[model samples]
Target: MSSQYRTGSRGSAKAKVIALVGAGALLLTGCTAEAKRGWLPNVERDTTNHTGAIQDLWVHSWIAVIIIGVMTWGLMLWCVVAYRRRKTDTGYPRQLSYNLPLEIFYTAIPLVLVLVFFSFNNTVEKSINAPVDSEVVVDVRAKQWSWDFNYNYEGQKKYFAGEQAHLNTDGSAGVEETLPTLYLPAGKSVTLELNSRDVIHSFWVPAFLQKLDMIPGKTNYIYLTPQVEGTYAGKCAELCGEYHSEMLFNVEVVNDAEFKAQLAKMEDGHIGEEYDRQPNKVNSVVVEHGHEEGGK
Candidate 1:
C-alpha cells in the first residue's frame, strides 16, 4: 500500500509539472489568447465610444456564458453525487410530477434572461443607429470588381480613383478599405455613403463593428469611429461579382496634423463635364476614323 501511494504521488507531481511547463511555453511563445480581441495588441484601454459599447457587450456575454456553464455543471454534479441510488433508498420510490411553482420558476427565469438579451441587443443597435455628427462622409462606388471612394469634406467631394493602384482595379490605386487608413483623424465620426453600380455589395469592418449595404441606384450610410491608433482592415462582406474577394479597402487613422495635410491635396472634378468644354481626345479620334472608313 505504501509503495502504491508513492507511485501515485509521483505521477501526480509529474503531471502538474508538465501542465505548468506547457503553460509557460505558451506564454513565452505568445500563443495564448490567439483568439483574444484587440485589448492585448493595445495595453491601454480603448477610448472610442463604439469600442466601449462593444467591450461592454463582450463582458456581458462572458458573464452569461459563465452563469450558464456553472448552472449546468453544478446541477449535474449534485444529481450524481448527492441523489445517487443509495442503499437507504433502494426500495421503490414515490413518483412525483406537475410542480407548478417549479415550472414557473424555470420558465420565468429563462424569459427574463431572453429579455436581458434583447435589451443588450437594442442598446447595441441604438449605439449604431444614432446620427454621427462628426463623422467624415465617404461616398463608395462599386464596379465590376473594384471599389472606389469619394471623400466629401463639407460640399467638396474628392474622388480617389483606383485606376493606377492595384488596391482597386487591375493595377489601379488602392481603395480606402477602412477609409482614410492612418490618414483620418481621431475623435471624428464618419458617415459612409455606400452605393453600387451593377450588383449588390456590403462593406464591413469587424474592428469598427459596423456594416452597410451597397445597393444599386440608392445610397446607404454607416457610422464609425476609430478609438485607437492602429491599422484595421475591412473587406467586402457581401458577394457582388467574380472578384468579390479581390474587393478590398483600408482605413487609416492618423493624427490631426497628418489628416489636414492629406486633405489639402484633394481635388475633385466631373470628368464628363470637363469633356463638354472640349471633346475627349479618344472620342474625337474614333469619330474621325469612322468618317474615313465610310469614305473608303
Candidate 2:
C-alpha cells in the first residue's frame, strides 16, 4: 500500500508539472504579434527593408545563446548527478591537472562562435550603411532641447525649426503638435545628415533598431529606405542637458504625393542662413548656458 501511494504521488507531481508547462506554452502562443517578436515595436517586416534582417539576427542570436546555455547547464547537472561523492567512495575519483583536448575544444568553440556573430553583424552593418543615390536628403540638426529638420530635394530646401518639447509632470514624452516632424516618401531612398548645433545628442528610433550620435563640429549620416507608411516616434538617446528627455521628434513615412505636398507647404519657409550657413549661431545662448552648467 505504501509503495502504491509513493508511486501515485510521483505520477501526480509529474502530471502537475506537465500541465503547468503546457499552460505556459499556450499562453506564449496566444501572445500578441509584438510579444512574439520579443516586444519589439510593431513594424511590418515585408515593408520595412531592414526590419526583417535585424529581427532575424536578434532572434537567432538569442536562440544560439539559449542552446549553448541549456547544453552547459545539462552537462553540469549530469556531472553532479553521475559523479557526485558517495558514502561507498573511499577516496577522490581520478583527478587530472590538465585537459589539453577539452581546453582546445572550449577555446576554439567560443572563438568560432564569436567569429560567426562578428561576421553576421559586419554584413548587416555594411548593408545598412552602404551609400545610395538617395532621392531625399534631410539635414537633421539637434539642439539643446529641440530639433531642426531641413529637407533638400530637387535643388530646393525647406526647413522647420522645432520647439523644445514640454514634459509632463510624470516625465512622459508624447506626440505634441509643437514637436518637429520629418517626412519621408515610402519606397524611396533617404539619407539623414546628422549634425549638432550645440552639444552631443543621439537620434534614436526604436522601430528602426538603430541610433547614431550627433557631435558638434562634425557631421554624421544615416542611410535608410522607408517602405512602410506610418508615424514612428523618435527621441534623443544620449544624455545632453537638463531637457534632454524632451528632445523628441516624429518620422512620418508617407506616399510620394503626400511627401511632396508637405514640402510644398514649407516652400515659403526656406532654411534660414543662421541654421544653414552658420550652424553654431542657431542657439548660441543656450549652448553657452549648457557649457557653463557643465563646468560647474
Candidate 3:
C-alpha cells in the first residue's frame, strides 16, 4: 500500500508539472498574438515594394525564435529545479543512459526548421529577383571612392550622367557635402545595370532594403520600384580602399514630371556632350581621375 501511495504521489507531481508547463506555454502563445499583430521591434520599417514582404518574413522568423527560446529555457529551468540534488535524496538518481526518442526529436526538429526557413526564404527571394518591366534603365558605375549614375531616356539617343559626391573643402567631414542625386519617378519600376571600374562595391540604399555587388568585369542588374516619395541616402556597403567612407550618394524619388525635368537638366548641362556619348557593347563608361569619359 505504501508503494502504491508513493507511485500516486509521483504521478501527481508529473501531472502538476505538465499542467504548469502547459499554462506557461499558453501564456507565451498569448504573447505571440502581439507578434501576429506585428509587435516585433527590431524589424526595419517597410518603405518600398520589397520591404513589406521582407518585414513579414522577418517578423514571422523572430516569432519562431521567441517561442523556441522560451520553451528551451523553460525546460532547462524545470530540469534544474525538479532534478536538483536535494538533501533528502539519499542515493544516486536513476541510472538511465540514453533517450533515443528525445534525441531523434531534437534532431528532427532542427531539420524541419531549416527546411521551412529555406522554403519560405526561397519563395521570397524568387519573388524579389523576378524580372521587371522597367520604365527606366540606369547604368551605375562604381569606382574607388565614388559612384556615377547614368539614365537613358526614351527617344533620347543619349544617356544623361550624374557626378560623384565630393567631400567638403573645409577639411571637416562634419559638414555634409553635395552628393550626386539619382532621380526616380514614383510608382515606376527602374532597372539598374551596375559595373565597377576598380574593385568590388555594393550599392545599398537602406530604404530600398536592396543591394547588389558591382564586379569589375561583370555587369549586374537590380530592379526596384520605389513606393514612397522622398530623398534617401545611399552608400557603398563594401569595404574598398582608403576613402570608402566618402562614397555617399542620394536618391530622390519624385513625380514623373519632376523626374523628366531632372533628366532634361542633366542633358542641357555643361557636360551634356560627355553624356551624349554612348558606351560600346559593354555598357560601361570610362573614368579617368574621377571624371567620366565616353564609353569605350
Candidate 2 lDDT, tens digit per residue, 2-58? 999999999999999999999998788647655665544466675457878887787
TM-score for all predictions? 0.65, 0.78, 0.72
Q: Report the poorest 10 consecutive residues by lDDT, candidate 3.
A: 268-277
Ranking by lDDT: 2, 3, 1
lDDT of 2 at 173: 50
- Itemize residue pairs with steric clashes in candidate 2: none
Model 1 misplaced regions, further than 4 Å: 1-47, 87-93, 163-183, 264-267, 270-296
RMSD of model 1 against the true structure: 9.7
lDDT of 1 at 76: 92
Candidate 1 structure quality by residue, lDDT tens digits, 152-257: 6656656554431135446565554433332456767777777765567787766676677877667787777656766666667888666676666676677767
Model 2: CA > 4 A from native? 1-36, 39-42, 169-175, 267-296
Per-candidate Cα lDDT values, in order, are 0.62, 0.78, 0.73
Report the number of the highest-lDDT candidate. 2
lDDT of 3 by residue, 144-212 (tens): 666666686674423444344456687555323467667788888888888776678899886676788
On TM-score, who's better, 2 or 3? 2
TM-score of 2: 0.78
